[model samples]
Target: MTQKITIDGKDYAVGKLSEEARNQVVNLRVCDQEIAHLKQRLAIAQTARAAYASGLRKALASAEVVEH
Candidate 1:
């Protein structure tokens, strides 16, 4: 069976790839979803990191100093 794939606004024919190649394509699609999820997780982590840094800075500024 033949399948058409659209890439860059152009249609290309992709058919009868080897079994290994087809498996690789399927694996790549799964990896793509994982990458997307990781990106979202990274964004949340960054936000948390920024908030922690801000709180740390405020805490440092508000700390009591002891003079000798």
Candidate 2:
């Protein structure tokens, strides 16, 4: 079975693509992978930030009680 890629609503066989076109496809795939990775990293960082904020709020509340 031939690998097909769609571009601008048109489908082309990967095996028929020119060398430069094939290289561009590879670059696009790499870029897509990196973008997905960065998005996952961003989600993890956001979750950590929220946890840290919650911890800080709890710590401050405890400190207030200790001082009182």
* Cα lDDT tens digits for candidate 2, 1-68: 99999999999999999999999999999999999999999999999999999999988887846453
| lDDT string, candidate 1, 1-68, tens digits | 56865646976556656677667767878998999999999999999999999999999899997789
Query: Which runs in model 1 stand beyond 4 Å of their true positions?
Result: 1-15, 66-68
The model with the greatest TM-score is 2
User: In candidate 1, which residue pairs get closer than 3 Å at backbone N, Cα or C atoms, i.e. clash?
Assistant: none
Every model: Cα RMSD to truth: 3.8, 3.1
Clashes of each: 0, 0
